[model samples]
Each structure stands twice: as C-alpha cells, then as structure tokens.
Target: MRQTIRNVSPMSNEGRNAYVIEHLTDALLTLLRDHSINDVSISELCECAGVGRASFYRNFESKEDIVRLYINHLFCEWADAYEQGDDKPLSALIQSIFAHFERHRDFYGLLNERRLIYLLKDVIIGICGPKPEQSKDDAYAKAFVAYTLYGWVEVWFQRGMKESSEEMAGLFKMQGL
Candidate 1:
C-alpha cells in the first residue's frame, strides 16, 4: 500500500511540491531499509512514493539529492532551535550539536547502519564550512572547525553513540576547544 501523503492543500503548487518531496523522501528511506541506494531505481522509488516520475524529477535530481535535502532540512530545524536558546557559548553549541544527533537517533542510526553516513559529511561542511570570500587564515580556521565537528559526529556514530551530549560537550571543554 502507498503511504499517505500529508499537509498539501489541493490548489497550491508549492504545497503539491512539498507533498511530492515528503512522500518521495519517505519512499526512499523505506526502500533503503531493504535495498542499497544503488539497487533502488527511480521507477521503483516513484512507484513506492505513489507519485509520477515527472513529479520526482521536478523535486529532486536523484535519490541522493532527496537525502541531502532532508539532511539540510534537519539542520535548519536544529539551527532554529539553537538560535532560540539564550546560551551561545562554544561548549553549549557543541552540546546542542550532540543533542540534536541524539534526538534524531533513529534516522542517524539508519544512516550509520546502512553506511550512508558519508552523505552527512558534505551537509555538515556546507552548513559550517568556509566561504570562498574569506581570507586564507579565516577560511582555514572555519574548515578546521567544520571538519573537526564532523569528525566528532562520525566517530560518535561509529562508536554506537555511548556518550551523552553533555558528556561529549564536557570532553570538548576539557580539551580547551
């Protein structure tokens, strides 16, 4: 049976596109539970999502693109929550990062289990990586921070995330980072 699509108003193009995106994302993730991304086809994904092929192409270039989009969406959500919090210290930021991952353990765990966590690296870098216009030193600093944070995340996932967010933040604080 096709999964039920939600939250789209019948007449709005934006709503319809959102519906397509949501369904296709769910479809791809569901499919991934049983098949590798390479083994999943566009036709199969479209069928599973209950959307036409044209609908799929209109919203995403490929299955990986859908996953990337979803990852970005999740980060945007975390950023919103972070911005709302008053404490903006480095340790707090680090703790929030770990907390966000802990909150989304199932999705992140799936990525880890399926070896798709590499897809998260670019998204993390894009969100915090250096901009092209920055000076060499500034660019290097940003790159260092971004890659270091990604390293923490990767290692945490690989280790089955035994540490709590507060504990990880404490480790970072102890390191004088």
Candidate 2:
C-alpha cells in the first residue's frame, strides 16, 4: 500500500530521492520518538510515511541511512547559512548544530537512548569535507572531533538537556574549541 507524499521540494535533481528522503525522515523521526531504530522495519516506516517499500529502498540503503541523510541535510543547511568572509568559528558552528538538534530534541533523545547516535559518524566525516592539504593526522583529528561531539550530544540528550543551547555553546567556547 503506497501513500502519496506531499510538501517536499527536491533538494537536488534526484526528485524521487528527495521526496522519499523527506517523507522517510518524517516517518523515522516520528517513530524514533516511540521506538528504537533497530526495532523499526522498512514496512512500518513506509506505512507511516505513506510511501511505497520500493521507494524506500530506492532512496535509502537502510534505516540508519535515513538518519545519515537527514544529518547531511542539516549540515548543508548550516553551511548555506554561513556568510563569506565570516570567521566561521568552531563555537559558532557547534552552537548552530546544538540549536538545530534542540528543535528535534525528543527525536534525538530517543535515538541516543537506543545508542543509534553513532549513525552521525558518516555525516560528520562528510562535513569535514575534502581538504587537499589534510594529512593523516588531520584525518584522525577530524574523526576524533566527530566522535567527541557525538559523545557530548548523547550525554546532553540523555541528561534531559538541562542546559540551553546557549549554555551548551558556552561550554564549548570555554573549552577554547
């Protein structure tokens, strides 16, 4: 049973991919609030989104891929919001990230509980981008940064996010990152 998806603008020429991604993301986030990603089946997700099972496969390799693609989308948004000649401080970037996550706190909190936060790894690496001058050590540093941020985010979500996004940003600022 396929359900029609509306309200999605293709982020790329891959209109079908974009459509599936938007609907799948909505369904996954909605479901993650109540269930672990590991427990989510493709059929259940497709049913929730009113999308077809074949469509889901065409857009995503697995359930975790949805989270990764969504994170990619978030990173693209953050990058787009940047201004040329801007300092682009790490604190500013981290703040934007935390603030964005705050908007979907419940969804991420559940994912953290299920230890699916590791899914952000690829997204982080992608954000690191391709630096021609990047050395092996730089690659390690990038991975370290990604994993560290993931840990802090998981902790924040697990602790019920008592700190406001500003406070979280301040914490990083104080650490000189």
Q: How accurate is candidate 1 locally (lDDT)?
A: 0.87
Per-model C-alpha lDDT, please? 0.87, 0.75
Please give, for residues 1-177, the per-residue lDDT of candidate 2 as tens digits.
533355434356487676777888999989887788878899999999877898888777899888877777766776677544478777776777788788777756666777887776666556643345789878777667667677777788778888888898889788665
Model 2, runs deviating above 4 Å:
2-14, 83-85, 128-132, 135-144
RMSD, every candidate, angstroms: 3.7, 4.5
* Reference-based TM-score of each model: 0.88, 0.73
Write down the worst ten-residue block by lDDT for model 2: 2-11
lDDT of 1 by residue, 8-63 (tens): 35557888788889999999999988888889999999889988899888888888
Best-matching candidate per lDDT: 1
Worst lDDT run of 10 residues, candidate 1, spans 1-10
Instruction: At residue 131, give the lDDT of candidate 1.
Output: 95
Q: Local error of candidate 1 at 127, Å?
A: 3.2
